[model samples]
Target: SWELLQKKVFQNKSCLSELYDVSLEVAKRCKGLPLVVILVAGIIKKKMEESWWHEVKDAIYSYLGESEEYSRGTVHLSYDNLPDYLKPCLLYMGMFPEDHNISASNLINLWIAEGFVQDVESGRLEEAAEGYLMDLISSNVIMVSKGGRYNGKVKYSQVHDIVLHFCLERSREEKFMLAVKGNYSNFRLSDWKESRVSFSFSDGLSEIASKTRKPFHQHLRSLRMTLIKGEVSNWSAFRQFSKLRLLKVLNLSSHRVGRLSSAALQALIHLKYLAVSARKFNFHPESHLPHIETLIVLCPFSRTVLPPIFWKMKTLRHVEINDVVFDLKNNKKWISEESSKLENLRILKQVAIKIGADDNVDVLLRRCPNLQELEIGILCDEDSVEICQLESLTQLQILRLSIDSFQLNVSKLRLPLHIKKLVLRGTRIESIVSSIGGLPSLEYLQLVLPTFIQLKEWCLGDVTFHKLKLLKLECLNISRWDASEESFPLLERLVIKKGHELEEIPLSFADIQTLKQIKLVQCKNKSLKASALKIKEEAEAIGGSDIIDLIVKDKGFEDAKKIITALKGKGISATEAAGFCWG
Candidate 1:
């Protein structure tokens, strides 16, 4: 418990040397409860003075009197001690269901919409919101559930059951928000005056909408229907949503509500964030949502055409569409104007652009000069499509390209110099290594799912990925990997999935001091597994025994069991061997 408390309190354990006795005493007062230790550690880490430590120690001792109420009391103390700015931000997390892995981006967007994030002089509101999330994580109030595949940043986060319960109770007391679950027959909007309402189950949506009259919803700032238990065919409730004139955030992305008419959306003038799943979206941004900032459409099965007016909305910051096709041809006249630029746009994702006689991807990209992240799908039947002008997007940091079925022209591909993360899928280009290796700022690269056939050989000859950290290769048939430690000097994690034909990882990877993890999934070669073990041993010999980890996953249970047996034979404990090998 003391060790865990120290780890939670200080990143470098040496900082606790001076306060070792006091800190140990504080840890012991928690009665060996991990949650209590963590919560107390979070509270006391901000101040290192001996007086503050004693004060915290006394407070914990006073609160943790009963064993049954110890965890709850600690949680309450943690909440009471949180900084004023973080109070609302932490309370907002109760909007999500228990055990729900909340997307960090979605949570940050909601916080920004709710005015919980303060403006930072040096950065955007999104960055400030991210800082707020990090503060919560550091305080141990929020737990990171999953890390991003590329950068290993906190992508999904959740709170423990006790913390969540405390948040729900405190939110109710403060009338900050109300989360409704199961039936809504007894739910009365007039009785509850919270500004935010989250419905865990969607069955009560229509009932609540029909029963709740005007003036009750006028004060509502946020409404979210997170989970759908059944198909909701009666979307007439959305017509009633027009009464929510003061609503700032409305998230109905869980259910596919067939055409949400423009009349219903035009009433939400104050809406800053909107996420919905619909068969078709026909609203005009200029006439309707004039103050909208973040728009997310979650219709993967249907192809939605983005309105040309979106390019002219300066208030718009982030736009994400799943399986969306940009109708640039029909809206050419709208985009042709030189003044129509998305100056404030920061993110555009999964937007399919057709390169033909009418639509030029370059023309559309040039309009969003400040775009930082872009995920585009190229639909071209020709031999190659020219996206060579991406370097014009000086602010572009993350880029993902998905090609339909043609081979990408590697020679003509010009990536942004400042790009940090890049993902290419369904683009069958054999000479991609040379084109991407010399990137000065590239950090994360993922190449997955070639269109027709996997590229047979990948030779990383002399070029270097200077800042590359994580490399992921999926559905590739590369039989030989030729490279040296010089190729990826800063490479930290290597992931290979479905690389059945791959012979072995380059032995020189063992020489890379920064390499920490090598994960192989569905690779059937025994030699590959043996090579991975050898690499682990070599990394241990050079660095320390705890430096590198080798993870193997196979579909066949027998194969995984055999690998586990081999790992145990190498002096690894049964539990550790089982963790290293998964079926």
Candidate 2:
């Protein structure tokens, strides 16, 4: 059914219809596999075209055959394809139950530190994790999607119930997948005819504090996470060990360690990625774990914000948050500030930051040199200030700004080479765009419409962006469309939405030779709907000589009266497109 709908409807529908159809298709495919659906959606969005439908359909068909053995929604084929090394890794996830949303970065680092994804070609754990998850998702193994509308990328990932059942079943053989899942209460020792097992529960810590006691797990390789909320005297999850060799990633991020005890530090001799989020995490840096690679301190601020100076744990790659009283507030604070400065992070320009008047943005940016994509959360509430000189960022390719009031010395903030995907939202920054240095490479540009904007003022006069393509806008209250300089050599999609004050579209863009699509939407306004009719007439008058795609952005039924008025002189259907949505 989805294949048929995609073939017959999706391509020719309005933006809303397209989204609706795609979403339905994705939901149906999930079959309780929410993680798989979300992951597939992201992979599909990377390259959108008619081929997208074909590829998605093909992938689904392939997935159906793989996990045929698993009950209902569980994917058996994908499970069968898991490599020997990765099987233990996937089963390890059983520690977390259904609806459990874990941060992808934190989980990946734990996996890497456990000698899971050691074959790092680019020398980046996050990058390698993204690739690994992409493959898993494409194969219909998991899901990924945004949890909320935070104007940024998705953070938490929820797992399916069926996926958990499979993981628990597989863990019986190796005795892995033990840290979480209600502190291993779900796994009864009688159920496991295994003596050489690990203990990771609250009772162990309770015993350790009451009496210098320790529950040893000689065969335990790693403690993925310890998710208790309050204070515990010993290790938040893992208590003791005897012959554990690969005790790599220890994430006690959200637990309270009353004091950084020497005994706890001594147990993790082979630790690599240690994400310890406690109230008083004042343990010996060097003597405790000399080979630790990534040490994270999660606070509650979330990933959208990065804090000030972090502890210089020499072997650490990521850290975040500030736990002054020993309680971890913001999870993002655990990510080390030092990771951004590493020379290898030049390729990681997709930085998400909230820069305010109090923030020293200039100092913060100095750490990130090869920034390609910058998603800024700016709040210019008091004491309006100018942001850092963008010219220093020689490699910024994409810029998405959410500014309350962005005061930039535009003169000195030069556009980096090959800039693409520029998005400006919720701002009244009336400034001149004199020279956008890399105009050619820009493909997608989104501008949040204000009540009034000087259209001509932002023009790069008589300039043709040969490479400029898709441009989108939402709830932008502009007066008219300015195609007066619409010389986009290959413009494909132009989308404008939810404008209350839009009277007309720029007459200049009607005869765009290469234009393939134009989309418009009206929200809560009758006057704007009438203007849309008028604009359609004006646009048709110009469209008479071109094969451009005409989109009508309007609300309410433009019945007999509206049609008569629109076609009074310009005889064209304001409601229909001959082979498309011209009706």
lDDT of each: 0.80, 0.50
Candidate 1 local lDDT, residue 78: 88
Put down candidate 1 lDDT per residue, 340-438, tens digits, no spaces: 887778889888887766677787888888899999888875745554457789999999988775555545777788889999987664556667886
Where model 2 places Cα greater than 4 Å from the true spot, the runs are 1-113, 122-127, 138-164, 179-213, 216-341, 344-364, 370-386, 394-408, 418-421, 425-441, 448-477, 484-498, 504-522, 526-572, 575-583
Please, what are the lDDT tens digits per residue for candidate 2 over residues 1-583?
3433333233455434445555566547645444454434434544455466446645565456334332332344346555566565566566564567767666676666666676666556666775665555444455564432212334556556666677766676655554333454465433433322334444443332243322234334455444444635355433443234446655555565544432466666777766665545444423445566665554333232222222223354443434222111232343335453533233222233434554455655556565555665554435555544565676677776665553433334455556776776765423424344246677777777432346422333555556667767677655544445355656666676776556544545544555556666654444444444444445556666434444554543444445554565475444332212222
Per-prediction backbone clash count: 0, 41
Model 1, which residues run further than 4 Å from truth? 15-18, 149-152, 228-236, 261-263, 283-287, 381-385, 450-455, 537-547, 557-583
- TM-score computed on alpha carbons, candidate 1: 0.90
TM-score list, all predictions: 0.90, 0.55
Error of 1 at 356 (Å): 2.5
| Residue 72 displacement in candidate 1 (angstroms) | 2.6
Clashing pairs in 1: none
